[model samples]
Each structure stands twice: as C-alpha cells, then as structure tokens.
Target: MFQEKNRHLPCFAHTLDLTASDNENMKPLIEKVKKTITYFKQSVNAADELRRVQPEDKTLKLKQSLPTRWNSVFYMLERFLMLNKYVASIILSDSKAPEIMTASELEEIKEFIQILKPIESVSKELSGEKYIYHIK
Candidate 1:
C-alpha cells in the first residue's frame, strides 16, 4: 500500500483558477470593463438602449464577472468583445454611459481572450470530469 504523505497531487482546475486570477497588470483594465458592464446591468434604460441598438441577429447581453465564479472574467470579456460595436455606439451617444474602452485596451482584451481560451477549455474539461482514479 502507498502512503498518502509520500505522494503529491495538484488540482488542475485550481491551478487554472489561480492563473486566471493572478492578473495584477490587468486589474485596472478589468475594473474599467467591470464598471462599464455594471452600469449597463444596473440601469434599465441603458440596457434597453443597448438592446435597441444591437443587431437583430445578435441577442447576447453583457455579462458581469463574479469573484466566486470561475472563468467569469473570461466570459465577460468574450461577451464584451462580441458586442463591442453596439457598446461603442451606446457610449458615444449616451451622455450617461461610461467612457468607452480605448482602442489599445480593446486590442489588449482581444489578446487576453486569445491567451485564456485554451486555459479555459482545459479548466472546463478538468472540472467536468465525473470521477478520478487513484493508483493503489
């Protein structure tokens, strides 16, 4: 029999979570994006304005990231990028809307999403597993 103390195992999902969460360089950008999303989410008029401006073919709404939820930031960013055009229009026309993300920030967000996609996929797969086998 093997002693539990002699072997070490790490949680892949947890590792991924840490990697995603340890983004000090992106905190400011992320915060700005979060605030923008929060504005839309909390204001019925803003949400309605977004809906009205959005294309008929696209129905997805902005997503807010929760601290407790895994990969929420990624999802939020992904959705934000998806609706970037509509969001920009709203920000430009609405006096109450938060300032729109700069072109550099938007580009950085696209790069960030590219980097996180694979990690997110792996995390999802690891988390979705129903069982794990332990060697005896």
Candidate 2:
C-alpha cells in the first residue's frame, strides 16, 4: 500500500502492521502522534538532509536496515516508536516552562505527554518482541 502511494520514498520497511486503531485508552495519544508524524514527514528535504549530514556508516546502517530489510515488523514499529518518543519528549520539554508555550499550547502538549509516556513505556517493554496487551 505504501509502495502504491509513495513509490518515490520506497523504504519497504514500512510494510509493517503499524496502523493506528481505537483503543479505549490509547486512541487520542496515538492520534496526536499520527498528527505529529504527518507534520514531520511533510519536510522530506529535511529528513534527507538529516540523513546526509549523518555519518556515512550511520546513514548506510539506516538505509541498509530499513531500505533493505523492508519487511521487518520490529524494525518499522521500532523506528516509528523512536520518532514518536522524540517528538513527545520535545513537546514535553518545551512545555515544562510555561513561558515557552502559550497556555493552551502547554495544556495540549501536557495532555500529549501524559498520553505518550505510557505508550512509550509499553513499547520499551516490547522491544524486539510482539506485545499482547489485555485490558482489564
């Protein structure tokens, strides 16, 4: 599906089971993360620039890891989780001092942080294995 939609940015590692779905607890936070990713991905040039300035070995590793492995479920979720964690942290840190963000902005990102931390914790526990979350 990604290949059909985004052939130019064909990193086959994206074919993982990484869809956002409604969870009684996780839906809103996951939606926030999805919104952040949409904003981030809009800057294709910047992502490429990040890849370029990265050390050759690091760049090669990223390309080899994803562009080559194209079908690893662990790799895709790991990558997405990594990005989501970073964005959440940035939002959290920026919101720490009230002056850095408007009241409404701080409130929104505060909610974002609250939602994301649990998600981050669960992902950390899963690591390279599949998770089976059961709601009580």
Candidate 3:
C-alpha cells in the first residue's frame, strides 16, 4: 500500500477557503462590514429600522459571513452591496449605528465581489453532484 501521506490529497474546497481567508488587505474592511452586520443583526431596533426604511418590495437584508464557509463572504458582500443605500441611511439616522462605509470602500467591495464571484461559482459547481472530474 502507498504511504498515507503520499496518498492523501488536499481538498479543493479547503484550498478555496484558504484563498478567501488569507486576503490580508481585505481583513480590515471585512471586519468593518462584519461589525456593522453584527450590530444590525443583534439590535432589534436597528433591524426594524432598516426594514422599515427599505422598499416594501425589496425584502433583502444584510448577510454575515461564516468563518467555516468560504462562499459566505461572497454572499455577505453581495447582500451588503445590494442594501448599502438603506444601511447608509440607517447609520446616518441612528446615533448608535456603526460608521457607514466610504464611497471608495464600497467601490473596493464591488471589486472584491467581482474577484470572488468566479471563485464562489467554481466552489458551488465543485460541490454539486453533477460536476464532472476529468483527468487531463
């Protein structure tokens, strides 16, 4: 039998996780987004305020990234970007709300989302049962 070390292979999903988690430049901005999301999630009043201000047809809300899931970051950022206007309004109106993201930072998030979209799509495809693995 082959040695266990030689036979063992790293998981593609894990590698993707590493790629997302190891982005040092995004850490600070991600932390800020996380904190803002957490604050809104934890504060009933803030969440209610956000919901109240949001368009009746637009029920989408903020999303928080999960440490264990690599694609969660993409979802979180996507949802945040979608709801940015409402979030900014909340932050402006509420004294207790976290600081709003700057225009440049929001643009950075947009760019980061573009970078992550393919990674997220690939990860999902890899996880699907229909995904084909061809040995080149």
Candidate 4:
C-alpha cells in the first residue's frame, strides 16, 4: 500500500539482513554453532550420527550441507539449526539420544526456531510428502 497504490500485490521479500555487520551482541549463537559442528565433524562417530538422524526426509528433499570446510559463512546466523542438529546427533547417542546443547546455545537456538516456525514445515501424507498445514 505504500508504493504506487497497489500497482503490485505486495509480495514481501525483505528478510532481516543478518550479515551486513558482525554485531557480536546479537549473533554469538551462530558463531557457537559453527564451532560446535566443526568440532563434531572431527570424529567418525559424530559424522555417522549426523547421517542417521536427519529429520527423516524420505522424499529426498535436499539442503546445502556443511561446507567441505568451514568459513565465515558457515558461522552465519541463518543456517544455525542445520549446524546444531548435525552436532547434536554426532555427539549424543540415539538412545536418550539427542546430543546436548550448552544452555545458552540452546536458548538462542530455541529463540531462532520460534521466530522461523511460521515460514514452512515439511509433512508426509498419503499423497506423499510436501510442506503443508497440520489439518488435524
């Protein structure tokens, strides 16, 4: 409504720019995740566990994985959960079985996940899996 009086349907495309500056006050968890995942990959058991505990995306839905090596981008705030889960499975056994996160890291991850919950979720159904609302 602000521009040209509805000339466009107003598709909202702006995401908060997280990387334009390294505001340490706001983004330390992202840095922590990158470090944790890097450490997790240093051993074989951890790597195998990451392969096993993926969210069970049977449909072969793909995602950009950890870089062949870590970099500044690996520490970006956007992909923290991918980093978090990868580490958790690797370091923790599958019985009780999720790996533990440090208290502060867990808190930050929860906050980010909550903020992102509205975007989309993958679901499975008789028609096969796709992103959809929980109809039940």
Candidate 5:
C-alpha cells in the first residue's frame, strides 16, 4: 500500500525492524516477555509482589516495550534479565503470575539481547547530532 502511493520511500530500516520483530525464533519469546510485562503493570498487587522479591540494591521497576519503539524492547529486556531471579520468585510465589519462561527461554532472551546490542548502539549513533561526514 505504501509503495502504491509513493514508491520512493526508504523502507530498509523499517524492513529490518519488521524482520527482527517477526523472526520465527524470536516471536514466541518476545510475546512472552510482552505478556509478562503487561500483566505486572496492569495489576497493583502483582507489581508490589515483584518489588518485594527484588533485592534492596535493585530498586528499578519492570518496564514494558513500546510497540512503536524498537530500542524500547532492548531496554525492557535488559532490565528484565537483571531482575530475572526476582521475577522468577514472583512467578513462583504468585498464582496469578503470567506464563513463566523456561530455562531455555531465559537463555534465548540473553542471546537476543546480545544480538540487539550493536543495533542499539548504531541507532544511538544515527540519532546523534554529530556530523556523519565532516568534509575536510
């Protein structure tokens, strides 16, 4: 549809983003993470339970990824991995916790994070004000 109106659209980046999001290997894990985040955020008692499981040193709350922002997923997963143990405890302790990820799923998330790290860095670089090419 977009091509039908104006074919000049530079959709390479958008294509990449879509590929990453819809990849067969990642779809399930991403959905699970999204569901988990949503469940906690929607319920006050669940959020409180998650906080209780975390150690005193970590005070950050779980964050959900914005549907429109690709990097937000990385940020969300990064924090989620950091609080993995606490999250697991919350799942075990609360009967209402969203579907728990398996050990393999946790490992896969870590791998996905690593895959996205360089892309995230590139995204930051592209958004910076510094000149891409200083014609000296």
Candidate 6:
C-alpha cells in the first residue's frame, strides 16, 4: 500500500465552485460582476486613467475573474466592493464604463460577498501546507 500522504481526497475547491455556480441567484450576479471587470480591462487607457484617479491603495484596483477559477470571482467582487467609491468616480468620468449597477444590484453584491466569505476561508485553509485553521 502507498503511504497515507500519497492519496489525495476530493477537491474542496472544486466542490465549492460547483455549489456556488449552482445557485440561481449567484449566476446572474457573477456574470454582471464579470462584465464590469471586462469593461475596465477592455481599454488600457481607461484602466490606467482609473488607476491614476483612485487612491494609492492596491485593494482599490479592480480584478477580473477567470472562467475556470472560482476563487477569482470572490477576489473580483471583494476588490470591486473595496473600490466602489473610486469605481463610481470613474463611471462618472468615463463614457466607457459599460453599465452601472443599480442600488439593488450593489446590495446584491454585498450579499454575495457575505455568502462567499466562508467558502473563501475554507479554500484558503485547504490551500495551506500546515494544518487547517492554522491562521485562525
């Protein structure tokens, strides 16, 4: 028999991804947030301009989600929420801001972040080399 450490269990990250994707409410909001990221990435000039316009904090920068990586969506939303004020400023100045989310949509994003936080923490735990909950 192989060593105990040689065997790998089911991937928690993949399970989390599937579970989140299966949620009907999250589907549309994830797409909307992805679209917002795409809008900012579509033009280097506009993205650079936004960087200049926002504060020096790195968390204020927008992040795009990858199609295959579930955690990226969480990071994207987290950063987007962090940078909302600067994002609003950019939207006010740039005609290419794509579509602005309504107040309700913003509230939805906030809710989504709350929903994802636990999974995000679990994913982080599973990714570490040390014992789970090491940082906690």
Error at 44, model 3, angstroms: 0.8
Q: Write the per-residue lDDT of candidate 2 for residues 1-136, one digit (tens) a residue.
A: 3468556632221322222112345445434444544444555643454455546764521111133332232332344443433344444543331122234543554554454455554544455456444445
Highest-scoring model, TM-score:
3
User: Judged by lDDT relative to the true structure, which candidate is superior, 1 or 3?
Assistant: 1
Model 5 — which ten-residue stretch has the worst lDDT?
Answer: 9-18
What digit string (tens of lDDT, one per residue) describes model 4 on residues 1-136?
Answer: 3377557432121112222223365356555555555555464665566666666663121123243312223234445454555655455654423336676767766665555343322111222434433444
lDDT of 5 at 115: 88
lDDT of candidate 1 over 1-136, digit per residue (tens): 4377778577778679669856998889999999999888988887898898877786779999888777888999999999988888888888888889999999999999898898888888888888886757
Tell how far residue 25 is off in model 5, in angstroms: 1.5
Comparing 2 and 4 on TM-score, the stronger one: 4
lDDT of each: 0.86, 0.40, 0.85, 0.44, 0.76, 0.74
lDDT of 3 by residue, 1-136 (tens): 4477668545687688569756899999999999999999999988998899878997878989887776888899899999999888888988888889999999999999899888888877776646545555
Top lDDT hit: 1
Task: Order the candidate numbers by lDDT, best to worst.
Answer: 1, 3, 5, 6, 4, 2
Query: How does each model score on TM-score?
Result: 0.86, 0.31, 0.87, 0.40, 0.78, 0.76
| TM-score-sorted candidate list, best first | 3, 1, 5, 6, 4, 2
List the RMSD of every prediction in angstroms: 3.1, 13.2, 2.3, 11.1, 4.3, 4.9
Checking candidate 1 for backbone clashes, the offending pairs are none
* Candidate 1 root-mean-square deviation in Å: 3.1
Across 15-133, the per-residue lDDT of candidate 6 in tens digits comes to 77667645787778778777877777887876787788765765356888786776777888888888777667777777867677778888888898898889888776665535533
**Per-residue lDDT of 1-136 in model 5, one digit per residue for the tens?**
4457656644444445545555687877888988988888888987888777767686778888787775777888888898778777777777878878899999999999898887777665555535544334
Estimate candidate 1's alpha-carbon lDDT, on a 0 to 1 scale. 0.86
How accurate locally is residue 28 in candidate 5, as Cα lDDT from 0 to 100? 77
| Local error of candidate 2 at residue 54 (angstroms) | 4.9
